[model samples]
Target: MSGATGTGTTMREAFVATAGHLLDEDPRVAVVLAAISADVFADAARRHPDRVIDVGIREQLLVGVAGGMALTGMRPIAHTYAPFLVERPFEQVKLDLGHQGVGAVLVSVGASYDWAAGGRTHHAPGDVALLDTLPGWTVHVPGHPDEVVDLLRRAARTDDRVYLRLTNDGNARAHPVGAGFQVLRTGRRAVVVAVGPVLDRVLAATARLDVTVLYASTVRPFDAVGLRAAVLAADRADVVLVEPYLAGTSTHAVAEALADVPHRVRALGVRRDVELRGYGEPADHDAAHGLDVAGIAARIHAFTRA
Candidate 1:
């Protein structure tokens, strides 16, 4: 219900506002969460402690309880880290959430390796790529603040299973979450589909170059028309699909789907040969793997102009 922004509504403030809004609507919307999404979850509980049921650091039990709560007609928003949400209770996520087709709102903090300093065990970089292949799961990576707010509210109302990837990538701004893919930058230079927060990197990339940036919010339910238009628009330009996961499924799947598109498709992501290490920042880590703005810009320039 909180739609309009007043004067100084930052994304973080809007985030808590949405949570409070949901809690106000129903006091039974229990938040089952762990340590990762502690920030927003805690704030939500602080504002409406009666509605949130904290599960400490127990991600498995947290989700299991949430799934159980879902069975009883309560909306459960499970907040946890990406690695654990999809990794630990993966079976619960599949059976309790997926097979049952229950609606589970997963608010993941630093869902991707966007956590940077967390290292491998903590780095959930490949989670989205993995979720991309999973059936009955809606994977959403909101790049900007507005997209986050809109999608978070929508997800709250949705009665399906979804795992949200939230992060603090330096350029993640507040933008509306459009269903179809959008052309952040329209150019013939080369189509670099900015995956999620990577779109911000895409914008930063354009500061010194002439590259096209496509803001792709929904990774799953891959926007066929939007993606087709975004990709086909390239019209034989060397195009690359960049992500923060390994060079397998996420990239290959996209490449296969858009193979018919005239553009020469390429993928830029974690090499996977080595465990992804970071310099404690999303941009730096992505830059290290040639997945950041400049790196993607370089690839587009090399592939298109080469």
Candidate 2:
């Protein structure tokens, strides 16, 4: 329940450590890791060899094994980089998990450009978008280590299919888990929904504007009910969705949520039009995608003014 700020723990570290603890605490818990992040669970594998498994560099086998384990009544927590986790074995995820109706907690790190130096092979800006194609996947984008811990635990306990996304980028603070958006700042001009790590940037962007800022750790299952309430409270249809993935990933959901009412929405996130070959750091990619605080502020100002 406590935030991991200044605790010298990264979100990836928290995920691995917490998963190991789950393996020790719960007999039903099984962790399947690719060679990419196997080091994080080294101790867990040593302790629970039967429950903790490493499939080497095989991404398809990673997801297939997890799906098979889930079918046998084990709570499988699969971890790997974003591209390998979701992109490489997407069909396995779609058929093994989705087609079979089995559930597993798919936890991923190196979100989008976290490994910008590693090039496009390491980046996965479309991970969430791809998952969105499937049905009944609970997608969680945790902004802080605390949120990661909480969301991971929640996923482990459920029989529902879940995806916990972790990244190097994070917000300054963490909020409690709940349905819909948690209103951080109340305003009437517009409603800005910041998904996961983007909360900090969105807050900075709209600091001077009289707009409601809502933060969400759980994005899939879109929280249309919560969004409608915020928009109605603001008495305006100006909705700004700042996701951490591809732009407009959730635009359809937002539009559907406000279908009965008159509304104007602007979806912001990483751009998919072109590949950003100038990879250096996450900040560099963020700037290129116009997800930095300055860029977000400019977009918000223009949208609100119009």
Candidate 3:
């Protein structure tokens, strides 16, 4: 619903829509989010106390508790800041949730430069690599708020463990739902796919380079078949998977999937170490390291020449 600023609906509204519809269908839909968006889930929780579990500032406890609730047959949707959700409780996440193979969904906000002034400490760019490595985990990186709702629906229907990488621009952006990448446009030279905030830049660069734009919302459980299809569709053109995380996009994941396709594959994400300058918003820091849209567009074009 949050369709990019003045385009459609707000992200908070989309979150509400997704949660509200799911709750209506299942009275057992217990919510376990944080105070970050308390008002968003409060109304639903107020109406159904037995369905909401608030664990403020305790990300590890929140996730562990949610896993326990799921084991006890209570459907819990735990929410928290992306950094806290994964970093604060890395062990709890790896052992309590991943190792045990918990079936609850982790709806994380502040994903990938969503935090402006919080600096590198607050930014969450490691989620993809961390979550993907955990056994039996499914990761979804929705391009917009609309896709957030769609992915949630798909998660609800599936039986595997899930995590939605979230980014709130303080505005709403729209995203589509599915298991993997979706090409928004076609090109003859190369295939350009975006993972996070750079989708906007990719759309703009469509005219600059003889390239096709693809949106990759589902990070893990990557559709190798889908990647192969994009390569084949592009006449075996070069394929690039883009991301803002520090090399989180799985080049190997795509490479293994499209091994037979004759094309060079490169993953575009933040480098492992840029020795960032003290502090600033996540976007500024990312921009300094060529993680912004302009940098992303340039990289895709370079691949075309190579």
Candidate 4:
């Protein structure tokens, strides 16, 4: 709530600006890029030539360099496209950062298939799922540029292994930065958990339905306590999870959270069953995956009715 007031800036731009500011303010902060946003950081690179690094097109080295920096007690902010950052160098991420037990901020843009024209190779719906394989990683899927500004500051301030997923999609407003979920609307029928940029769509999809809507930006530390509390308060155990990444990525987490209680969860997001082959807008992919407002409303109706 205390971030930007619905600024029109995109999350990617917000990150570049905030990162440059961090380089100016925090001496321990370093930025490692893989030629994704090198042009944007050119000025900063000129200013802090030592701290700002561009490792050409080597993503493996992008993370490797960040790990090396962390070894020297520096908090490195690594940036690149989603697939290149998380999928291409996953082993490096697992070993260089996770296995070595060093901390760095891994920021990514192009959520899922934001670059629909870039095709499947550019898509990374499984990034979060893959990262879940590692322990001690904090994942943040910010829904607004305001949230991005706040989350980046928090990530840069610490040397924790964090993945801040940036996307072209964003909510109309941003909730305060917190580990737990923030309830936007309360209802006794069911609870809808909207992750990151999908909050606005979820709200529109469920506008007529009587259900509780909870917004979550920090998802890695899945707020089980907050989820359980919302479920108990709502009285109905039917829960719906709408994320912007791979569908059911957080289904297991939801199941574990409500393990003791009898609950039913419907996970919705980018599908894993089939790869969308056509090159269209992100909205096309959303419709194909049943993530658009109409698709979401229909799915929610069917799930709740069943």
Q: What are the TM-scores, per candidate, against the unseen true structure?
A: 0.84, 0.97, 0.88, 0.97
lDDT of each: 0.67, 0.89, 0.71, 0.92
Scanning candidate 1 in windows of ten residues, the lowest lDDT window is: 1-10
lDDT of 2: 0.89
* Per-residue accuracy of model 4 over 59-79 as CA lDDT, tens digit each: 999999999999999999999
Tell me the tens digit of each residue's lDDT in model 3 across 58-106: 7888889878877776666777778888878888888776677667888
lDDT of 2 by residue, 130-221 (tens): 99999999999988998888898888898889998899888777789765688899999999999999888898899999999999999988
What is the TM-score of candidate 4?
0.97
All candidates: CA RMSD in angstroms? 4.0, 1.9, 2.7, 2.1
Runs of candidate 1 with Cα error greater than 4 angstroms are 1-14, 35-50, 170-172, 206-211, 245-249, 259-263, 277-283
In candidate 4, where is summed lDDT lowest over 10 consecutive residues? 1-10
RMSD of candidate 3 to the true fold? 2.7
C-alpha positional error of residue 207 in candidate 2 after TM-score superposition, expressed in Å: 0.8
Count backbone clashes in candidate 3: 7
